[model samples]
Target: MSIPQKLFSEFLGTALLLAIVIGSGIMGERLAGANEAIALVVNTLSTIGGLYILIEVFGPISGAHFNPVVSAVMAYRGLLPRASLPAYVVAQLAGAVVGAWIAHAMFDVSILQLSMKVRSGTGQWFAEVVATAGLLLVILRAPAARVAAMVAAYIGSAYFFTASTSFANPAAAVGRMFTESFAGIAPASVPGFVGAQLVGAALAVAISSVFAGAPVATEIEPKPNV
Candidate 1:
């Protein structure tokens, strides 16, 4: 695909992902009232479904890489052109912000806001590392046909297992900082989360190299347009 088409795919996919994440959190919180667990379950289920669908729809286009870390890893692996990495990251980040705004607009909330929810400390950061590492490992090892389902399932599971609720993607951590909803993470917490995610991604890369026999061809591999 052309550069423009690839960027657009990343942008759109990332935007929709944030929308699903933030919107579901908002909806879940409003309905769940005092039950935070219930709200989390709602958010997890919505995100899982949305992620699966988005990957299926956009995987053929831009590899549906809605996360900057994912794009960076793929570029490092030579699956994506190094020259395209900057554009891909920019598109994903931009889309994440827009997606947060779209979710706020959908729920008739203020579009401009910052999260005050504190998400930091060693446990949280470690969870991010674990969460991100597991995510990359899944993507690297899963069969191409099962990538969507496996990824979605892993993320949904991580939402509960990880102490930080697994903002495993830097784009996600950034996007969540824009909202004060249940899904949001305070701006103050973003740097730590992002840093942890990077470490986790790096660790995953190292481990996958040793654990897996070879890099498995997956849906995330973009193809040239004929």
Candidate 2:
């Protein structure tokens, strides 16, 4: 797509993705009573559905990279221009804040709040590393036709398996930090989560490069503007 169109798609896609995540968490927490597991299940399912749709809708435009780390990896692999990385990151981060605000508005909560939920420690950080690595691996390996489903499935599965609920996307972490809902992560914890995610992304790229050769065209589908 054209640069403007690509950036717009990324912005909109990431906004919707964060809205789904935070909104679902708020809804689930309100309805699940004291059952944290039930709340998580609802959140996971909704996120999976939303993720699938967003990827499908935007993949043809900006390759649907709603995460800064993913965009960085793509640039490193030569699938994206290095000069485009800053725009992608800026769009994703801005979209994340907007998405969190929208979620709060939908839930009738204060828009001016920072998460107080403290998520840290070696185990949680390790989980982020593993979660992010697996996410990138799946994206790298998925066929063009299956990228949407595979990515959604992996995130859904990671939610249950990973201690940090698989906040594999850096933009997602930024969005969640702005809220005080069940999905929110304390602002203090964001740096750690984001750092771990970046390390994991780098590791995934290294391993994939060793085994999978150079990047493939499946990274994105053919688009007229692109």
Candidate 3:
């Protein structure tokens, strides 16, 4: 498939994700009312479910990356072509912005809420790195392990636990600026988060390549303290 087609897929897929993000974030914020854990749970489930659906729907066209982090990792590992990278990023970002707009319109809320900022300290940054790393690692190494189920579950689960909600896609990270709800990423913070996610994805690409030719390391089994 052409990169443009894939890029379009990313655009649509991420739009769907933001729609969910906005709808869920607003509902959760109102329902949870300062309960961080509940808000987190709601956001995670929405993200996981939305991603699962988007990947299935968009995979045939653009491999449904929906996330720049995923694309960067895939490209780093030779799964995606270098030429298509820029197009994919542009399409993904455009889609995200549109998606955020629609989401805000649907809820009849101020778009500024779409640009809502979260207080991130050291813990959040490290969490973003770890979360992105896990997501990239699973996608990169899955075929080797023959884990048929890992494909969707990896991303879904990563978003559930990731502090950044695993914004793993730079475009979506930028697009999310449209919503000021719980899922929103401030314009100012987008670059930093995106950079960190890229770093995490790049590391995964290197690690997967190192293990590609060599067999994936397996542990020796001892008879459970028998």
Any residue pairs clashing in model 3, and if so which? 6-62, 68-169, 113-179, 113-180, 114-178, 114-179, 114-180, 115-179, 115-180, 116-180
Task: Name the weakest run of 10 consecutive residues (lDDT summed) in model 2.
Answer: 212-221
lDDT of 2 by residue, 1-226 (tens): 7999999999999999999999999999999988999999999999999999999999999999999999999999899999999999999999999999999999899997799999999999999999999999999887878889999999999999999999998999999999999999999999999999999999899889887755566655678994
Best by TM-score: 1
Query: Against the true structure, what is each candidate's TM-score?
Result: 0.94, 0.93, 0.82
Q: After superposition, how far is residue 50 of candidate 3 from its true place, in Å?
A: 1.4
Local lDDT at 62 for model 3: 82
Off by over 4 Å in 1: 212-226
Return whichever of 2 and 3 wins on TM-score.
2
Candidate 2 clashing pairs? Answer: 1-225, 1-226
lDDT of each: 0.94, 0.93, 0.71
Instruction: Summarize candidate 3's per-residue lDDT along 90-183 as a digit string, tens digits.
Output: 7777888888887778778865554658536665676677767777777766554333246556656766566666666677678777677777
Please identify which of the two predictions, 1 or 3, would achieve the higher lDDT against the true structure.
Answer: 1
Prediction 3 TM-score vs. true = 0.82
Error of 2 at 216 (Å): 9.9
Clashes of 2: 2
The candidate that achieves the highest lDDT relative to the unseen native structure? 1
**Against the true structure, what is every candidate's RMSD?**
6.0, 5.8, 4.0
lDDT of 3 at 133: 75
